[model samples]
Target: MLRALVFDFDGLIVDTETPLIEAYGDVYREHGVAFDRAEFERQIGHASFAFDPWRAFGAGADREALEQERRAINLARTERQPVLPGIRELIEAASAAGLRLGVASNSSHGWVEGHLRRLGLHGFFSAFGCKGDTPAPKPEPDIYRLVVNALGCRSVESVALEDSAAGVKAALRAGLWVVAIPNAATADHDHDGAHWTVPSAAEVSLPALRARFGG
Candidate 1:
């Protein structure tokens, strides 16, 4: 039975990836350097992909200042975005269905929790497994294992909602049924690995999912 539902935070819960990439692109524009969007997109949903944004800057560039600027832009842009369509409905449906709700992410707990709180969604999830909670992040099963165990759920009894290829990979590795719903930033990713692929969260139905996977 599907006893739990786990969600990926960034692009899944909110479209933070779009604003994040835009922010970096803005910083690069200010410095007259072209941003490598494809390269940065590759880092989405990945915990430890080695790529530096400042490598394009001059030798004397103040990396710290650039980081601050990027953060500010990202925050400002992110603050303007509303919760994605159908996410609230899904959460409400899962809650009413008596399934444990959790978050599994490659992001830090503080980052995930803070955004959830700001979005008035922090109270919804019963468990969270983030970067420091495990030795590895998405594309590995560590964080997913931590969250499912925390929720007292067997991997096969849980379903994961993910927006990235790496997130799908992690959930599958952890043995959970996964639904891939691509957001603007992750729409180009290969999500064929997921058990189901939907254009948006609006298409997900609790009864349908339970009927298909809960048994």
Candidate 2:
């Protein structure tokens, strides 16, 4: 039986990833500098990525002020984002079916929880295994394992809903069935590692997922 469902936070639950990248791009644009979108994409689904987005502005640039501006832009854009399509319905259906719901993400617990709460979907989750909760994040299976354990279910008895290649690898490594639903920002990512790929969360249904995964 499918005892649990674990979700990835940023791109999957909310489109925070796109807004964040756009915020950085906006800052770069204001300074008449070009933004390397492909470079920023490297940090999409994992934590502790080594990237220096401000190097293009040269040594004389005010890093602190620029970061502040970028953050403000990001916050404004992020606040306007709604829960991704069909995510709310999928969560509701999974909940009504008595399946445990949880989140496993590379982001900090505060980040994930804050967004979920803002979207009015926080109460549906029972466990959250985020950054600092485990030794490592997605691509390591640490976060996924932590959440599955917290949900009191084996990895095989759970399904992982993800939006990135790294997240798919993590869930697959943890032995859970993975469904990849890439967002606009992640649409170009290679998600061949996932068990299945859907255009959007709207294509997902609890019954169909369980049937596909033998839950």
Candidate 3:
């Protein structure tokens, strides 16, 4: 029986992908390098830190400088970030159904918290686990394991809602069932091992989730 629902913060819970992509593109333009959206998605989606396109452009970019630039752009964009459609309703429904809620994402705690606060959804989660909270980020089971443990639920009694292949792998590796909601940025990625790959979280009814986990 599923006792908890874990979520990925960025693309899954909110529509932050477009803003992130725009930010990266803006930063790249400063250095006279065009940012390739597809390439950026492929690389940065799998890494904890933002990729430095200037370095890839052979500009001898310093990692710290790129990080600073990325941070400034991200913060500016985040101020206007909005939650995904039906996200609040789904969260409220899940909460009303008595499902424990948690957040596990590759983003830093500050980034996740800022977004959540902006959307006024910060209080819905019982626990928030971020990249720095765990020994490693997504594709690693540590963060998912931490959430299940914090929720006081068995791994088998928990379900993780993710939008990326890496997030699915991490949740599954942690012994929880996974429901994938692939976003535009990661829709082309393979989710062959996911228990289900839905178009959006709005389509994931509470009954369907419970049924999948035999709760």
Candidate 4:
């Protein structure tokens, strides 16, 4: 039986990833430096990649002030970030069906948990696993493994919903069935490693998912 459902918190649940890229780009623009969206993309859902925009912009600018502005821009953007489609329905359905729900992310615990709480989605998760809770996060499978254990479910008996290449890779590596539900920011990410790549969050085939996984 599919006893659990694990979710990736950033791009999957909210569009925080896009705003982060935009904020960084905004900072670069203020410094008269061209921002490489592709460069920022590498850092999504994994901490293994580097994304120091000031380095690209030159060192003359006040790094602390620029970082503060970037943080403000990002916070403003995320204040209005919409929860992606079908997520609520999926969570409600999972809950009604007695499936354990979890959120595992490469982000810090405060970031993911705080947003979920603000959105009133925090109450739905049985487990919240993030970078601090594990030795490694996405692209390492440690976070996913920790969440599955916390949910009291076998890896094979759970499904992971992800939006980025790193997250998909992590879930797949953890031996869980992975579903890719890309948002605008992650639309171009490579999801070939996922078990199923759906067009968008709304079109995710939960029924098909269950049948394929013996739920």
Candidate 5:
């Protein structure tokens, strides 16, 4: 009897991560600097990471102009990026089971909301919580707390679908039952802390959730 299902946007909903990383890589390449894979991996799943390309590369690249180019590239790449497998199915299944739907993310409202709508998923959520909506972002429990409160559901009766370690940690801290479903970028993430870790989103089920942590 799970009352609600909360999803993490970005890598979990749509793979904006790959496109964004590619865009960033392009920007670095333009300046004759190779993108640092290790540093990029460390910054994944957290929005507050220091991403000053100039400081990292010791280049005189204009940050604003570089940002604009990166955005343009990302936008072009995202136009063709498809929603992840099992995402739509999960949403529809949850909706049909009378579960209130929500999205909690470390991304900005404009970013997450607009993308959700474009992907034809904005109307499915009863609540949408993002960076500014809470005091902090994922890896902090603020975003998840905001979503649970907005949906008028207790944390114990809600289920969270997350792809990254930060998202899983946040949901667990907020008392939600978490299902970790990693995407390519987050496949190496440590999900041992989650209540359940699944190989794919299709394995996330309301019936299984109710059996474990009822509504």
Candidate 6:
């Protein structure tokens, strides 16, 4: 039986991908490098720390400087970040159903906390696992494994909801059942190994999830 539900923060819980892409573009423009939206979407999934796009596309630009610029841009745009449709309802339902919940993300703690606070979801998560909280990020399974361990649940008794292939891979590698909800930019990515692929979390009623896994 599934005792906990873990989530990915960015594209999964909140719709921050577009703003993040725009911010990265602004950073690239300042350095005279054109940002490729397609490439950015393809590469900037849950494993962002593993493949920092600043170094990939910045040419001779200083990585630390570029990261600072990106962070500043993101912070400036945080007020405009919006929660994903039905995410709050899903979270509430899951909570009411007595399922333990947590978050695992490739983003830094500040970034994750800021976004979650903006969406009034900061207190919903039982545990928050960020990039620096683990030795490795998404696509490595370490972060997700950490969340499961923290939840005090066995991997087989947990479910992970993610929006990217990297996040799905991480959860699956950690031996948790994974539910994939691909974003508009990453909808074309392969989800062959996910336990289920849903169009959106809105379609997944809490009762249905509980019926499938809680029992």
lDDT per residue (tens digit) for residues 3-37 in model 5: 88999998888998888788888888888887885
Candidate 3, lDDT over the whole model: 0.81
Q: Is 2 or 5 the stronger prediction by TM-score? A: 2
Error of 5 at 75 (Å): 1.4
lDDT of 4 by residue, 46-153 (tens): 764565667875667688998899999999999898788888778877888889999989888899999998988999899988877887767888999999999999
Whole-model lDDT values for every prediction: 0.90, 0.90, 0.81, 0.86, 0.84, 0.82
State the lDDT of candidate 3 residue by residue for 1-215, as single tens digits: 77899988878888677677778888788878776888767643454445545566565667678768877887677677667766788788889999999999888898788778878888889988886888788889999999999999888988898888888888989998988888888787777688988998778888877777775
For residue 178, model 2's alpha carbon misses the true position, in angstroms, by 0.4
lDDT-wise, the better of 2 and 5 is 2
RMSD of 5: 1.6
CA deviation > 4 Å runs, candidate 3: 49-52, 59-67
Error of 2 at 9 (Å): 0.8
**What pairs collide in candidate 4?**
none
The residue-by-residue lDDT of candidate 2 on 38-154, one tens digit each, is 878777897855777799999999999999999899999999999989999999999998999999999888888998998899999999998888877778998899999999999
Overall local distance difference test of candidate 6: 0.82
TM-score of each: 0.96, 0.96, 0.89, 0.95, 0.93, 0.87
What's the C-alpha lDDT at position 156 in model 4? 95
Once fitted onto the true fold, the runs of candidate 1 whose alpha carbons sit more than 4 angstroms away are: none
Superposition error at 82 for model 4 (Å):
1.7
Model 1 lDDT, residue 1, Cα:
85
Total clashing pairs for each candidate: 0, 0, 1, 0, 2, 0
Is 3 or 4 the stronger prediction by lDDT? 4
lDDT, model 2, position 179:
95
